[model samples]
Target: MTVDVEDYFQVSAFEEHISRGSWDDLPCRVEQNVDRILEIFSDQGVKATFFYLGWVARRYPELVRRTRDEGHEIASHGWSHIRATEQTQEAFRQDVSRTKALLEDVTGDPVQGYRAASYSIGRNNLWALDVLQETGYRYSSSIYPIRHDLYGMPEAPRFAFYPVEGDLLEVPVTTLELAGQKFPCGGGGYFRLFPYHLSRWAIQRINQAEGQPAVFYFHPWEIDPDQPRQQNIGLKTRVRHYLNLKRTESRLKLLLKDFHWDRMDRVFLEPAPSP
Candidate 1:
């Protein structure tokens, strides 16, 4: 139940091309969608974690306050949608720092966790983890243990494991190897693209068979059917984002009933030390 609080157009690669004006022109439904999510979770009596973007935190400060007041953990997702791997160490540090401060200002609570945009921390960007630790973050859910054009570290562990050199924890998104390929079970585009039962079964199998909890994530915009369509983007990005837009919310509600879900902090116990 780790929710990424960002608008659809705010994805990193498209940030340079998309303007703030574009956002104003865009249909705004994230707040409404989240209200619906709140209702669903309330009905189920579940509390979850929300990793909020500073941009979203600033504009929708009440939403942040409401989310925290409702017993959900509010964490940081950086100031802008900048990916950790693409920025210098200082730049990434500043982004996350600003995010932490802004979120705390809005919620009046400390934000101890983070999730990089697009799960962008990887082998070459291991330096980012050191920066994260120094910036007072206790854990990061930013690594994906699958190969992807945008982000992943294929050799990374599939569950919560502390890095030896830093205090920061690495809780990678859920991935399952199928047909000789590691597929992301992080439940974003993959969840929408695949059949509903397959996604549910994957998490169930992981939890029951492997004794590991599935870390699920989705953006506010993903479930918003009224979001604007981007122009001039590549075909894959469009399809990955905009496909089956209308079905996302209903499907997510259905998926919610199938599992015993909780925040990542509560679900992941600290790993045992190696010999």
Candidate 2:
């Protein structure tokens, strides 16, 4: 699962209390909070991976063609949310090649995946994963291997490897290791600061004790608890952007009925056939 389509005043903890030239005079609730997260992932059938934000897809091109005609998986959260360590590799290769050609010209498909605005491509800009595999992009949940004062790398590798030198795939976002440490059980703001049964027992111990598969993420202004709230920020960014914003859509419908989710290019760039 994933979402980060952006716009709680384009949050990078409200980029110094909101102001990318006042983000189009504020008050644009990411198209009614991504149409209530596409009606809670179509009432829990689940199929996510919506990294969006080429300035909210050039102002919601029919909410990215109704989240790609309701099946979901558009990907690419660059172009205006900056921070791939504040860009420079030719401005992060022209912000992921003009947000992957404006989200493949608004959903004609083929926009693989990318997610770096705020997971900021750590360890001194990992060449932004070779400019996301030389701008074709295959995978990148954008590294959040736990160690944060606003983004992490913490010596990377907590899952899906291949940091570079070929077939993309950086993955990272779900961490749970216990006694050896590494804590963030994926999903933004520690899935609203933990306690949804300890993030369903740390995603059922990363799926039955480390068999893997757990990326997870969240954003479309994190279930919009009456959004518009960023004045003079700092009580730890106002309790990490308003703590459990009205219990994040009932803990995301109990994390989509507690597990089995897809669409990071069909659980990491397709090809699971001939079973």
Candidate 3:
């Protein structure tokens, strides 16, 4: 399991509605929400990778330290919340490099994983993978294999695979294929949009039937139903962001109990046995 450590206002869906310039002035609830998440994970005895934004780390170093102290993995979610597709290669490099350095400085540990903002590193900009490797990351969970209006690389593999001929791994979020169609089972809006039982069933199928581990993710804002709602967003964005907010924490508890979850590095970056 992974948690995207960003605040609700930083969400890409609200970029148009909420300007980055105004981020500092807005109230931040990420610390409190993450505290709740940490409590849940501790109670369940699960360790997860937290892909934190540099912005959040700079503002809440204690939160990062607390998460690291509790045995969770700290990874980068870029310096700000800019999508990889939106950045030039140099800019993307700077973002990841700076964020990685900042996180490592805060935790005094080597950061080994990255997740692109909004899963924006698709076919057109897969050079981001090379940049990640260049920056010393071992793996990334940045691709969602299913097609969607916002982001996806539908042609990408449904499980962990090297995007290029290199050691750096690209782990796509989980999806269930049926009748040759891929449907997202990974966490995010889909986790809230679908019935909890449906998600449970799909994950079970992926585990038992396909013999593959599922890569699940959700944001810190997801469980905060009372977060300040954005105004003037279209009905679609409104529903996608706000639907079933109350159910996320409860459902997440069920998911933790229902399956075995570990840090992304532990689950996917384990060193191969030497011959």
Candidate 4:
């Protein structure tokens, strides 16, 4: 299992609705929600990777430390949640460097993983993988193979592959193929929008039929239904963000009990299991 350790306000969905200038003044709730997540993982005897934003780490060093102390892998979600497609290569490099340094400093371990904000490292910005490689990251889960409005590389490999030859491993989010089209089954809204049985079936298909591990992801705020919702956001964004918030935690509990999950590094970085 994996959790993006960012609050509801920092999400890309509300980037336009809520300005970064007003971020510090907002009510902080990631700590409490993440605590609940840790407790859930603890109860299930599961370990997960938490890809956190650098800005949050600066304010909540104790939260980062607490996550590390709980034995979960600490990874980067960029310095300010900036999408790679919106930044130049040099800018992306600087962002990754800053985030990697901050995460390593906070955890006292080599930060080996990265998941781009909004999965924005798509075809136009595959160079982001090169930047990640040069910045010393071992793997990234930034690209989603299915097509989407904000981000995707639909024709990309569904399972783990090295996008930059040998420098970095690109573990695109999980997808299920049907009628020759790739569908988004990785997690996030798809997990919320669809029935639990659908996600369960997709992962089972990936494991049994495709013979690969599923890389599912969710956010800390997903389990927090009462989180302050922004009113000025677009109707589409509001619906996608707010739909099924109350059901997430319960579904996650069932997901954990049903499947064996581990950090991205261990699952992809390690040798492939014999087919």
Candidate 5:
């Protein structure tokens, strides 16, 4: 899955320096990076679900059309890259509604799924699920089952399940408890930072041992090492966002070759309706 189809300046860490009002003046980095991704996927004949930021969609309607033309699923990544937990219920509702409207306008397809910025729907903010359902989203891939400083639901179910009174399907990032600690087998920086062999093994183990399909995610920025860098952010956040970026495309190609991957929607079918 993808999030925030935007230039590097839109990332959460750099939000202070970059304002959304001035997005048009900045370079079209996401467009170039996404082109590279498209070429890579074309080489392998792989299709994916791209969760687009409404901001990106409004700015680059052609990119959204091209993604659909090339056979990728179009979904919402909210209008701005703002975290749902940070917004009031009314604000979150509007954020999602506006994004969904904009994405549908560009793709001419109903956007049934969403992923929050930073995967921000957690224990306290899970009320966003009901908001999503009310706003017409049927599925969400926003929860991260593993614990993290920004977002995680450590005790949440590892696989897809219907939360109480909610119609949305929850698909957390794939992770495994190795020696009793959560490991990042699901990709992103973890895929680049760790030995490639280890990621391959972890995915194999998850599939063969547990019979669960692994969910992998990467962003356009992840592959754009030459993109402008954000300075003065905390070291850990910067590293998490930028480390191994230069090698991301190559590593993605290797991972694609090593594993049998399908769009997340294909692997996990729609959940049953509640009684």
Candidate 6:
């Protein structure tokens, strides 16, 4: 299991609704939401990877330290949450390096995993893998294998693979091909938008038929239905961002009981890769 540690306002969906300069002025709700998530995980006896935003970590070091104190893996979500496709190689390196340094300083552990904002690492910018390896990330769950307008390398491997030939493991978010169509089974808006049974069945199919564990992800903001509704976003963006917010926490609880979950490193990186 993994939670992207960012506030409701920090998401790429709200980029047009809010600016980076004004982020501090908005009510910072991530701490409360994450605290609730941590509580839920503790109740469920589950540990997870939290992909921390460098901007969030800087403002909420205590929150980052608390997650580490509770034994969750702390990983980088990049500084400012910029998309890899939007960043040049040097810019990407600087972002990851800075976030790694900050997260390591906060948690005092190696920040081994990364997931780009909006999963922006795609076919054209494959060089991001080399930058990740060069900067010392052990694994990345940044690619979505399904086709998407914003981000995906649809032709990428569904399971974990060595994108740079031995260093960083690229663990694409799980998906399943059924009825001659691909659907996203990995958690996010997809989890909320689709019936829980469909997700459950799809994940079961991947596990039983494909013999691979699915990597599920969600954000703390997802559980916060009462967060300020971002105004002025386009209808499509609004629905994708706001759909089923209240159900997220309960759905997550069911997911925790339904399948096995662990940090990205433990789930995909260790135990040796298949030949």
What is the per-residue lDDT of model 3 for residues 1-275, given as tens digits with 9 covering 90 to 100? 99999999999998999999999999999999999999999999999999999999999999999999999999999989999999999999999999999999999999999999999999999999999999899899898888899899888989888887678888899999999889999989999998899999999999999988899999989999999988889999999999999999999999999999999888887762111
**What CA root-mean-square deviation does each model show from the true structure?**
2.2, 17.8, 1.5, 1.6, 2.0, 1.1
Q: How many residue pairs clash in each candidate?
A: 0, 1, 0, 0, 0, 0
- What TM-score do all the candidates reach, one by one? 0.92, 0.32, 0.98, 0.97, 0.93, 0.97
Model 4, TM vs. native = 0.97
Prediction 6 TM-score vs. true: 0.97
Compared with the true structure, what per-residue lDDT tens digits does model 4 show for residues 190-250? 9999999999999999999998889889999999999987887787998899999999999
lDDT of 2 by residue, 126-204 (tens): 8878888988988888888888888887778798878778887777788898787898887777789887998888888
Error of 5 at 218 (Å): 0.7
Q: Give the winner by TM-score.
A: 3
Return whichever of 2 and 4 wins on TM-score: 4
Residues 69-126 of candidate 5 have per-residue lDDT tens digits of 9888888899889988889999999999999999898878888888899889889988
- Residue 167 in model 5: lDDT: 63
lDDT for each candidate structure: 0.82, 0.84, 0.94, 0.89, 0.81, 0.89
Off by over 4 Å in 6: none
Model 3 vs. true fold: TM: 0.98
Q: Who is ahead in TM-score, 3 or 5?
A: 3
Q: Show where candidate 5 strays beyond 4 Å.
A: 1-4, 270-275
Candidate 2 lDDT score at position 274: 19
Which of candidates 3 and 4 is the stronger one according to lDDT?
3
Rank by lDDT, highest first: 3, 6, 4, 2, 1, 5
Q: Candidate 6's residue-wise lDDT over 1-275, tens digit each?
A: 88989898888877877888998898989999999999999988888999999999999999999999998899999999888988999999999999999999987888899989999998899899889999999899898988887788888888888887766788888999877666789999999999899989999999999999888899999999999987778999999999999898899999889887777777776775863
Give the Å shift of residue 3 in candidate 5.
Answer: 5.9
